[model samples]
Target chain A: METKMVISNLLHRPTRTIISILAVAIEVGLVMLTVGMTTGMLSETARRVEGIGADIIVQPPGASFLMGFTPAPMPIKIGDLLEEKVEHVAHVLPVLILMNVGVGVNIVFGINREQFDAVTGGFVFHSGGWFTGPDDIIVDDLYAKAGHLKVGQKLTLFSHSFRITGIVEHGKGARLFIPLQTDEELNQTQDKASIFFVKCTDPGYTDDAISGIRQFLPTYPVRSMAEYTSLYSSNNLPALNTFIEALICIALTIGFLVIFLSMYTTITERTREIGILKSLGASKSYIMSLILREAATICVLGIAAGEVGTLGARRVLQSSFPTLAVRLTPHWMVYAAVLAMGGTVLGAVYPALRAASLDPVDALAYE
Target chain B: MEPIILTSDLKKIYRIGKVEVPALRGVDLVVPEGEFVAVAGPSGCGKSTLLHVLGGLTAPTSGKVLVDGNDFSAMNDADRTRFRRHKIGFVFQRFNLLPTLTARNNIAIAQHIQGNGFNPHRFQAIVEMLGIQGKLNHRPYALSGGEQQRVAIARAVICEPKILLADEPTGNLDSENSQIVLNMLRGLNRSFRQTILMITHNPDAAALADRVLRMRDGRMLLD
Candidate 1:
């Protein structure tokens, strides 16, 4: 019965209820969307790193683990240096990283043709064959589907049109691939590659190989494939924790202010009603409970709307940016809901206190 | 029988920007159990203040108000509030029914606040006495002025408190509706032997009570 009163009171003013609910929903949806995008990118980067079939990765020191496209180049001679200096070295492949400006935020991996094929397990090509020329590029199925490109179609990057020589399955490598020399010539970087991929002759000795390479190039960062993938998971994404903390603050503030203003004005409008309740033998605690219950009911309904809104938003984003993965896990939704509800309850405290403290005589006399 | 409510030297002062305005000035009063008493006065004679203090909605500046021989003046805010919920009920001039609630729930809430859930038998009796049984589901806006007042009276008596404090119960009613509402109150008082303290400016309204007291300028006048 008390719940019924709360619901009736909130529904009494449709416009006010809608505005407050929308405020909460929008804040929660934004938190979910932004956080989902960040985690999704982190997961995608980790997956791509593991797909290259390399046992170890050697990059410049201090390179961001999740920043797959960062131009942190090292000498291409590091490939040979590893093969000569490390005992377990089987093959070392150098990869140049280039940014694809024409087609969204994508990384282009430039590799030596022979070493790339040998180390990449040779692509399970869906159409066409390997890139036979310097100006040719190969794409995976995901990129082809996202960009509506196929074999024999030309893709324009850096104002240069290159024919798509092949389309392979995704999870094999980065979406776009080019010749190492072609990338170096186009980007004005001669004899430089972003990082080196090292394979050990004995699979069981990869850990030792990584340690040996680290010693040979102490200034460079070296990690086994498993370690590298784990490094790029959501927990290790640089600045991701800080970004979520800032978002939580923003979401909580929005929830608090909207609910506070709503409940404050609502209590003010119902001052006479509160007076009547008091005169009808209502205790101060009774009045407080009434106000708090109403506020909590609003919060619950708002959170429900926010949860549904987030699901709808995820679908729309996936359709709009097919290549952009959005990880809207159940855990994230629950966290957002709890945070929103907590903020709303806190917001209602002052208004509930004010209502409970009203002087019955003065409030009853209010016009 | 002992007086169910007693007040001696009851005074309430209002502060208006450093000015002390006395709303109740050393008023002494007594009402025995089962008595229906009316306090008649002009506006600003502090009748409402006296009613508020008697109901424990407001505290007196000095002296004592004992309801059921328990000192209300000595009780703290929380205790006074609890006392009011269990021991007193109120009806106002404006018929202060919650507009958002149905007439039935309005009455039921009185019992709900008394820390007891609704009693179906008691609720039915009050609604029948007030002739508001069929109108229980209607909101306040849908009820007539007389119906609204009767619902208010029913709400006040639903908890069966020791005293019912009414401030101008029929002030917002037409002459016909006023008589009907007064009749309901008289019927309830006679049937249940309920104690009532009513504040009113109408002579006819006062005439319905078992005893009448008149006040002017915050002091009881000889009637």
Candidate 2:
């Protein structure tokens, strides 16, 4: 009977019910999208590191794992020191990765082709071969395709035209690669490199290699491949948690306000109806449950709709913009559902209490 | 016969900020089991207030209301709500039917709240007696004023409460509808021996009851 009454009540006020549901759906969608983007960026970064085929990456102290200009570059001598001191070091490639300020989408890595290949095996080229001179560059196939560039085309980097000598087979590594000497000369850091990618003699000896490398460079951050994929690795991106936390707080506030206003007005409008129920001997708990059940039903429906909407948006976004991904893991979806539904339930509490505490005579007499 | 409904010197006062307005002043009343009693008064004569107090819908200023030998004043809000569900049913002038529900569901809700699932025989009997069997599926707006009142009566009696309270049951109906509703009330009282306390301004409505009490200035007037 209570369920039927709640359904009927909501049906009678179709406009209000629809508005409330849509409001909740939009808020839930926001949380999913925000959290999805955060986790997606983290996962994408981890995959790029794994694609390098290096057992460990050593960054300058306090340098972020995110691909960007390091706060301070480590000397090129670190690579020589690791190769000479660490017995487990199969190969060490000193590289400088800089964010392209002109086109924020690409992170340009300055690498020695021969040494990079020794540390991380060479890529499969879709078009041409590797850089033949200081004026030549290699790019990812997707980036080249997206930018309508082909081998032998003149590509602009730092206001200088360089020939696209090779197109790599669209791997997860940074899209832009240039000769290490050219980048060092251009960036005025000829003897300094951002970090070193260290390969282990054997895949199973990565742990031993990391400990051996750590002994040489005690101040640097050395992360193994397995640790890079874990959630704990997210700490390497400074302020990432704060940004996601702020977004979730905004989502919760929107959900709370929408449900609170909708349910509060509903209880007010149904004052006489509540009185009638009370007159019929409905207890306070009965009335409270009736209101809460109505709110929960609305929230669940809204969450399901929001989940579907997010998935549709994710597919469209991923196809249109390859760089952006919407990760809707089952764990995050459960969190989103719990958050949205729990906020709505909290919003309904005050109104339910008001409805429960109403005086039957006064309520019935309410015009 | 022992009185099933008893009130001793019932006095009720309403406080609005600083002013105290008396609605019932030292009025004593009693009705035995299986009795149909009507309370008649003009506006502001405390008939409705008396009904509200008897139904345990409101607390009295200084009074003792004993229904079925249980002191209503002694019971807390939760107990009173429970006691009302099992012991008293109410029929208002406006029908007070939930607009969202069909006529049948309005009655079913009463039984549901009373903690007793629908008894098909009792429900069918009430619907048949009230002549609302055909209109069960229609929402409140679809039913005529008289049919709505009949449904309200059916809902009140569906739980087979110890006492049924009806206040201006036909206030919104015409002469024909009012007569139909009055006839149904009398029939239910006679057939089931149900104790009924009704408040109205209509002498014709009062004539249907087994006894009539008139009130003026919150005090019962001598017949």
Candidate 3:
């Protein structure tokens, strides 16, 4: 019966209820969406590292800043130095990347098939097997599909007609990695590869190998997968995270203010009624529930609206930027609901108690 | 018969910075089970304060209150609320029914607060007795002043508390409605043998109560 009264009271004043709930919902949704987005990107970077099959990542000094990027040149040649001095390194393959390519730009990697398998297990063919000929090469799925090229189709890539022997998924870097011999011939330069990954025979030797790489190529920055992942997450989505946090703080503040005033007004209006309830042996907890329950109902319903709004926003953004998705996870939704409900309950504490503790004599006297 | 309520030298004081104002001063009182008594006073004459102290709505400045042989002064706020809920019922001036609820829902809410489901028969009987059967589904705002007061009365009594405390139950009604509400109260007193202590300024309403006690300046003139 007490719960019913609370619900009825909230429904009685629809305008006030909506505004308060909106405040709470927006705050909760912002927190959920921001944390989820940053966390997702971080996890994405980790998954990428794991896909490469190397427990340890070795990069030159400040190499993370140059990932998928081109620079003038490092003072040291990483691929050559690892081959010369790193003893525990089983086999090292140099991988080069050029990020944010224009349309139809072909990315090049210099690797030997034997050395490449030291990390990745090579492509699992969707149709054709691994590349077996010099004239044969793997074409990127994006370019292959766009130009209507298929296996055995000789496609023009970087002024070279290379037969599509197989297609490699972007899991290994999404770039084309021809043999070191072909790479040197095509690029027509003897320039050393920018970055080379060291594969250790024993997983325990990964740290030693990273330290050795640092000692051998001290002029280059060395970044492990851990540091790389953290750097990538901070760089890529820092703005989104900050915006989400700020928006949530503002929303919750607004929500609390709205709830505070609304509940105060509601308690004031029900002065006589509350006095009567007190007279009837209703406890303070019962009275508190009456007000807080109304707040809760508003919170749950507002969060429902926010969930739908966020879902729609995510779908639209996902379509625009295909690689990314706004995952409205169950965990995020739970977090949002908790924040909304908790904020509303806390906001309602003062007014509800004040109303419950009203002196019957005075309340009855209020006009 | 042993009295169901007793108060000895009950006093209530309100403190404002440097001043302490007495709302009730040195009063001894008693009401037996099944007796219908009225406390009559003008505004601020301490009638409401007297009722509140007895109901455990506020603590007395100096004295003790015993309701059904339990010392209300000794109970904590939560304990007092529980004691008040099951042991006492209250009716207020202005027909203080929850405005959003239908008449039937208003009556049911009291028992609901007790954590028990509605007693359909008891509700139906209260509705029939109060002559508000047609207004059961009407919100308090949709009902007449008289009808609202009757709903308020039904809400109070539906819990079946041992004592019913009414502070101006007919204050909002006209003579015709007031007489009708008083008649219903008389019927409740006879049928259930309810112990009713009413606070009112109207002598006619006070007359309906078996005994009338007048108050002036925070002191009970007659009991």
- Determine the C-alpha RMSD for candidate 3 after optimal superposition of all C-alphas: 6.5
Assess candidate 1 and give its TM-score to the true structure.
Answer: 0.95
List model 1 lDDT by residue over B17-133, tens digit each.
Answer: 999999999888989989999999889999999998888888889988899988987987778888888989898889999999999898998898887887999999999888998
Task: Please give the distance, in angstroms, between residue A327's alpha carbon in candidate 3 and its true position after superposition.
Answer: 4.4
Which numbered prediction scores highest in lDDT against the true structure?
2
Question: How does each model score on lDDT?
Answer: 0.86, 0.87, 0.73
Docking class of 2: high
Q: What value of lDDT does candidate 3 attain over all alpha carbons?
A: 0.73
Q: In candidate 2, what are the lDDT values of residues A1-367, reduced to their tens digit? A: 8889989988999999998888788878998988898788667766776788888788899986665758888899989888888978888888887777664457888999887899778878999998889989999876775677899999988876899999887553678899999888778787788978888889888899899888888888898867755633446555877888888888888888999999999999999999888888899999999999999989998998889999988988776666664678899899999999988998999999999999998999999
**Candidate 3 segments whose C-alpha is farther than 4 A from its true place:** A44-58, A65-193, A197-265, A323-329, B72-76, B115-117
Q: Model 1: residues >4 Å from true position, as ranges?
A: A66-72, A80-88, A233-240
| Model 2 CA deviation exceeding 4 Å by range | A102-105, A127-129, A132-135, A141-157, A162-167, A170-172, A228-232, A236-238
DockQ of 2: 0.85
DockQ of each: 0.81, 0.85, 0.54
**Local error of candidate 3 at residue A203 (angstroms):** 12
Record all residue pairs in model 3 with backbone atoms less than 3 Å apart, i.e. clashing: A59-A221, A59-A222, A60-A220, A60-A221, A60-A222, A61-A220, A61-A221, A61-A222, A281-B85
By DockQ, who's the top model here?
2
Better of 2 and 3 by lDDT: 2
Task: Report clash pairs, candidate 2.
Answer: none
